[model samples]
Target chain A: EIVEAIAGALGEGPLKGRRILVTSGPTHEPIDPVRYIANRSSGAQGTAIGAALAALGAEVIFVTGPADVPPPEGVQVVRVESAREMEAAVQAALPVDAGVFAAAVADWRVAQASDRKLKKTREGLPVFELAENPDILAGVSQMGEGRPGLVVGFAAETDDVIPHATAKRARKGCDWIVANDVSPATGIMGGTENAVVLITGEGAESWPRMGKADVARALAARIAAELETS
Target chain B: EIVEAIAGALGEGPLKGRRILVTSGPTHEPIDPVRYIANRSSGAQGTAIGAALAALGAEVIFVTGPADVPPPEGVQVVRVESAREMEAAVQAALPVDAGVFAAAVADWRVAQASDRKLKKTREGLPVFELAENPDILAGVSQMGEGRPGLVVGFAAETDDVIPHATAKRARKGCDWIVANDVSPATGIMGGTENAVVLITGEGAESWPRMGKADVARALAARIAAELETS
Candidate 1:
């Protein structure tokens, strides 16, 4: 019943001719076959956004890391595991009308991946060398050949969400940044609920707490409206 | 494992001495025994934020409407069914350190609820007379008795998300506004993911897309950090 209402709403203007690209989930920095460095992200947000965009009549290309949930129907899903692979996949799905960077890409990756699991040494803890992973959003926003009309990034901070998010937008050269706090207790990482702020070049907009699906639908509709005016 | 990690991170903070008031979910304005005016809100975001605040060691008072999900443990929860009830709950819970208006409250309610379901007319659909609901966030923000130090509101708009949110913040007399587009296609009404912008007097901060759980954690951490510095 609700799906029919949504379908009726989608039969309109704005995103009809646009192609959108989205990235979701946490990128793993492999340490060994049995171990890796990754955050507790489930990619629910990205999948919802992709579904929302598709419902708005836009073609969606979703690049995702390993996630516990499945991608929504009707989206072009490209599965990847590591930051490197995710970056490659995003790059391949270029020339999109808009790009939403929803993936919790690891800031750093293991310098070298070991194919086999390492046995625990009797001697204390082992140190793993880490290297900075390329900022996929920045790379795509600033260097992609088919530059998207609008590039959106996320700033997940434990403190100073707005200040850090503002700086990140400028540093990444993206058109907008969505800012949120991710201190462990929130349960927002794998939980079903969310609270968020939308930041752009002009200013910031805060949303009421609701379901992630509601947020995604609202965002897709806003994007479609913006595209129409642009 | 995640809960332990969060507890360790929030060992001590400004929120340690603070009290927070939060509202979540949708208000059901009943028209008849079997029908009511409500939205598709699950109160996930508000509950997550409440849990986040509690995790940070703040005394949290949560006033929620009808919700499918449970509130975070350890926080004082006040359940309500109508917008009027939510407003009363918030007012009673006031004099807190901060207030987050994350609930997706109905804007209107039936002026008078029928004790029994009204039979459908053989000729046409029934019409309902609705009255404007009190703006819970705005009212609480402007209250003089034990008003919170920081008042935050959320604006869910389909078009001109930022602009409309900015106006809402000013009109509501809140310290910050979280804004997002909640059009039909986004599936944000009852889903698990979200994308949003935070708008404040200083400006706006956009964030990338991530899980709602991460968003809640980050927001809790930010509030704690901000309270400490201020």
Candidate 2:
């Protein structure tokens, strides 16, 4: 393991010269001074993927939201909270060999997010007007001049996983989509194990249920192989 | 410290035979299976307060949300997620001598929280219809019978701290209100040190800035004195 680590550090792996951008964790959209909207993505899978890619000697720029687990070792980590911040951070690390959109960014943000705490009035509950957040993956994937070689997006669905993921892959204009069922019964949102369907241009490929680290390794290997061919 | 621990275990302190309840952390109100609303309360202050109460020989019931800090030792712990769940757990641990409502419970929850994740469509953003959560503090404070000897409430305000907390205490019919400024600039929302204003029947008493543990010890001692006299 130590020798492998040294080899990775010395740029000896297949992906030695490749630069990869990985966005991980759940973005928190501020509602008020004290409260915010958040997702249950713990960034476990994304963190593992970053580690795996780094192990393969990729120059990894990890733009992450507020994740439960700490960022992995031997990677450049950029922390962000809101989806807007994550988008900005990702844009800054642009023109990479591959872009992995793993962070579960909030689809919308409170349009009138209060600077001060909102007081409960005698009338009724406060109304939240939401504005759509920017689609970071689509923005980068459709970039004509400075697009990455490969753009991978993640789909965390609760129903009709394969169809939903396949549709997402088409809509996002990404090379591949790693989709997983995050239903409460599945225990995969924050759990270590992952059962994912990898959707590509050819078709949807279902991978066996395995640990997040193993899934990351398999995905990283696939990415490396694809990059090697192209 | 060893002697204190032994003495507390033996119920040899001022709060011997007294049962106290402490609610700590921020309640998560789910928007969907994967999305939720959260605050910055780490439960550091409440954890310290529970420990201090336990050390003083009180039978402490620690009701906690998903806090960054774990519950203190020597207390019966109850874990919960949403405000409604926290309210239920707190109700189950009632009829105590004193109740410290320290948890940053959400005042409102999405009325139409869906089991399935809401998807974006041509219709645009989803409207979040909110319903007011049960006011646990007020429910306990204004109880005609079986009311605790003392019901203390906490106010985390971004502006007009004293006035806001004072109004909150009066509205909730609580005996005391511990108010603190949680503005981002203060760095007190999730930080270790706290500068609080204690409001009683008389008036507000501002305490000098101090560590959360010290603040907890002071508050716990005050509660002990109040319970002793009552």
Candidate 3:
């Protein structure tokens, strides 16, 4: 561990002298004191990406949510719960060489989260109103001056994978969008294997089904090349 | 493991020939194909209880939701996800000597969970409607015949602990109610230590703060005594 940290500090691999930010896992939006809304993101892919980046000698900053898989070693980890918290954490980790937005952040949260536990009462079901969360990817991608050299976003869709991811890339103004079909049949959402489409300005490139770590290594290599070229 | 199972099968302890049903963990109510509502139930207490009962030679049938803690050894484990499935599992495990209702089951679920991932559209946030879940404890307690010899329910309250728990005991028609404060201030919800109140027909008895496993053993001992006396 000490040797790895020394290597990272001294700048040692393909991504030497580079700094990258990777957000992994699922942001939980609180409903009240006890309950919350969550998505099934185990953070396996994001953790793998962080490790891969670190293996390539990049100084990695891992901003994570409450993930089942723990964060990788040799990276700065910043943990957050809600989307707002995650956005704040991302803002704090600025001016990196590249940014990878992999966290499945909740799009909405309970508008008025009660201070106490919401009781099941004679008043019937409570009114549940949602407020839109801040768009972390779009905000960073569109930033004028302090934006990273390459901003990458992720899209987990159930249908029309290529079309949705392509639209998302254009809409979010991101350099690349790593899209995957997380349909129940595919079992990719919480599974170890992923078949992803890399959407860029040129076009969508589909990768064959592979382990999450392999995909992470491939993505990390691309990121290193992109940073070196730019 | 084999020896323990053999002991349970051969009726080697105080709770010999006894059948106990225990439900643990938090039931997740789906919001969509990707999102779900969850609570901070680690299932520590219930898992401990199952172990304790099995130690006393009881044939333990453990019905559990998605718990952070895995089910203990030497018990029949029935894994469930939602409140409705838990209720059905409980019904199927009837005619037991005692029943421990420890799961933090969701009181309500989305009226119509979407098949596809909910998209953030221009129309604004989706209208979220909820439907009350089946009262599992109350239903089991009010059974005319084939009801367990002793029915136990649990109450997690923030304020007015005794009153809420007492009222719950009456409402659910359970023989005992284990009540605890789950306010964020008290780390008992997901923590190993617990300070709980045992409410019964006689009165409310407050137990000193202790490890969840200790509490389970004491409760299991009491259950053995109660069954023996009857």
- Model 1, runs deviating above 4 Å: A1-13, B1-230
Listed per prediction, chain B TM-scores read 0.92, 0.97, 0.95
Tens digits of per-residue lDDT for model 1 on B1-230? 26643663464444676888988887767655434555446789889888778777788899998776888787889999889899889878868889999987776676777754343234534445656778888898788887777887987766677887888888889988877666546666567877788898898887676667777777778777767776
Among all candidates shown, the one with the greatest TM-score: 2
Clashing pairs in 2: none
Give the C-alpha lDDT of model 1. 0.76
Q: Against the true structure, what is model 1's DockQ?
A: 0.01
Q: What C-alpha lDDT do the candidate models reach, one value each?
A: 0.76, 0.93, 0.92
Error of 1 at A186 (Å): 3.2
Sort all candidates by DockQ, best to worst. 2, 3, 1
Number of backbone-clashing residue pairs for each candidate, in the order shown: 55, 0, 0
Itemize residue pairs with steric clashes in candidate 3.
Answer: none
Give the range of the ten consecutive residues with the poorest summed lDDT in model 1 chain B: B116-125
| All candidates in order of TM-score, best leading | 2, 3, 1
